[model samples]
Target: MKTIQYIAAVLCSLVLSGCSDFSDSINTDPTRPGVASGTQLIANAALYLPGLSSSPKGEFMAQYLAETQYVGTSLYPQESTSFYSWYEEPLMNLQAAIDSDDLDAGEGPIANQIAVARILKAYFFWNVTDRWGDIPYTEALQGSDNFTPVYDSQESIYNSLFEELKAAVATVVEGDIDNDIIYGGDMSKWQKLGNTVRLLMALRLSEVAPARGKEEFNDALNDGVFSSNEDNLVFRHLPEANNQNYWYGQIVNQNREWWALTETLVDEMKPVNDPRLPVYGNPARESDEYVGLEFGEEENIGTEEYSLLGSDIYAQDAPVYLVTYAQVRFAMAEAAERGWIGGDAATYYNQAVEASVEQWTGSTEEVADFLTQPGIAFEPGNAMKMIGTQRWVHLYMFGYEAWAEWRRTGYPDNLVEPNGVPVPGRLSYPDNEVFNNADNYEEAVQRQFGGDDDIHGKVWWDQ
Candidate 1:
């Protein structure tokens, strides 16, 4: 807690020095050309996603870009700065500006900004909780009161996020949608997304907190959640060449470096004749033949020989999907399995699979033909497995979700730990978290079962 206070003090000191990171990223600078507000800050916070899949963030996501672990591993690291926004001190501090001493009830109020910030905060904290487990949430984003805040249980954190999401959604009543950056600021979409987020969170906890998770899932379902693609929660990527794809910034630019599709992901798609495969992986190094390089194969051997997932999707640039129609469908399928709601598990699962095929190439028959096969057809426990597997495949470039889904469902059973993984799970908190916030860092580390953010430790929720 003291660390959070000191950090706050330092940030406050920085504010007086003429430049403050806290207010700067959020457009809090008064001298800027155009007047900025909380809406822009929410937008900037979401911007963190693109940078994640493409640059240093991409390397972290790829966890394979490096020559050392070329193929696969525990997925996320346990010791690097998985945090894309700790550096955004200004945005984190913006909350304080609103709750300050000098405030007018109606002069450029905090409603829109606070709503967006809460939603954005949910997204940001989800990344942390999704990756690390039981992060310092009640304490986090507080700037001072919560700095170095103790970690909460994963279950508690999930609950809190849902509450925050609900309140954020409520702030934007049905009629107000213009300011929404995600859906033309659509309040309905925001509300739908809020409920949809609730559904996803419940699904994540289904196996862990079946009862409470089920109740929450029902509430979200009954409340009306996203049902169509038009309601999908995503940030459209600009044709901006620099931000096209994380890989475009990292691999496509120079020597053409990309991770060969792991055999685990490859094999799962092969049996079902999944269409997305060709779109996801590169061809075998030897020829344009469609063959996947096994996950743990000797570094990069037979891979250069085969063509991976259809080249069409990879060639154009796959947009970063924070959440999608396919994911919601799969979650619904999982909910059915638990008998939490109406709908056949196999039915929703099949829809999810076909959704993947269609999502990749825009063809429903293609999906039908693929699902007609035995390996891909709807079966008892297999539905979730198939849904999870394809979801993982679709998540090839989208880092955190792929890793998080794996933790929950353990599906697509083919994913293999790479040859020389340094650590399992995500990287540790940033160096600054350790050096300056030593006590908090130490306590958080102790809460982590592995003594450090090692793969063996089960995040409280996962445990």
Candidate 2:
């Protein structure tokens, strides 16, 4: 009894003595930072912005590339997709940056840091809502405070994104930011990018919300956006293995023959003698001629028989474009076609084509020749179709944006799936949401998609 009592007394004393030490050390991870600076957080958030833009699935879905092997994603399957990483990692870091007050000490000016975070947050959230409609927005990223955030309607989300972007543009102040991988802390470039994002978002609502789209589109243009390729928002990849381009990682480092140019894109480029063809793809090994595999073809096609992605794209340091002046020009052309902006639609169209070609080839001779072709030249009646098709072509490496535009415009309307299944309108909600956030997920589906988490269910703006 005495020995037991003695042991208990020693244990209690140790617990009492170690409690403060334990508390202090429990959250202290030597290798990990307890609190990253605002700049570091901004850098972290910027890193994730290019993920979907860099992914092959977006290209495959847009019919820019056909799968040579492992064709599961090419054929639409009812699969769960998640943007959880965006919310959990970089978005969290961005939130921390916005909420941090240490900017005056070393982390850039408080207003600038917060403004940058808001722009990035809007960018990430825009991607999320586009991929999966009715996402958790206004109440999202609240951490444990609101585990089951109510999903905000896509319309409401768009409204808030516009407001956030406007505020972010207005809030830019003089400050030096660290670890700014995108713009190197250039506030002007960041402002342009924010406004450009707004422009793209505004154009997305053209069909469904024409009046609102026109207002926002003009507002973004007046606010200032990308004017030239020099103003492109690109994430320049490093030569190191960890930070190399996605195509280089997949095609060179992994030694995978997983992707090939699609006939849909090559067919459009070939007859027109498009200069971008050579830049977009390599000649096939067998024929030494540019040939693309038809997307969703059931026949076993060898990678060598079809053209591979261009060597420039497979380079270790190829940059991923988030927004380009070509895209902005195309948007303007479309806006002009719809009478939302003042300008000749053909002029903007020609400029967009020239910009896209020059961006790839760094010369105008081929573009001039290509533009003079009968079918290639801009026509007033067919302006919308011309704009949509050319926009798809210009958005070659930017697969997600291309796919989104295709969904919106339906220009290349002849896309066919081998299985006879229709193209997916949106990606299904993540499996984690279905399993963990069951109630909220159900509510979102019920309210937005007629009680089904279906890929074919169109988003609000798609109408």
Best by TM-score: 2
Q: Weakest 10 consecutive residues, lDDT, candidate 1?
A: 11-20
Candidate 1 CA-lDDT value: 0.58
Query: Best candidate per lDDT, number?
Result: 2
* Cα lDDT tens digits for candidate 2, 1-463: 3223223322332333111123355656565444455666676666666685888778876888888887776888888888788788767778877876565446567788889889998998898899898998888878778988889999999999999999999998887565577777788898999999999999999888999999999999999999999888887776765566878988888898788889888888888889889888999999999998988876868788999888887788887877899999999999998999999999999999999998888888877778989779999988899999999999997877887898999977767676788878998998888777889899999998899899999899997
Stretches of candidate 2 off by over 4 Å are: 1-34, 104-107
Tens-digit per-residue lDDT, 25-140, candidate 1: 66566654232334443444444545444443333343222222343333444445545264243336344333444332242345654665566667667666776666666665
Task: Estimate the lDDT of model 2.
Answer: 0.82
Q: Could you tell me the TM-score of candidate 1?
A: 0.81
Cα-based TM-score, every candidate: 0.81, 0.92
Clashing pairs in 2: none
Error of 2 at 298 (Å): 1.8
Give the runs in model 1 whose Cα sits over 4 Å from its true position: 1-31, 51-78, 82-113, 142-147, 174-181, 299-303, 308-317, 419-423
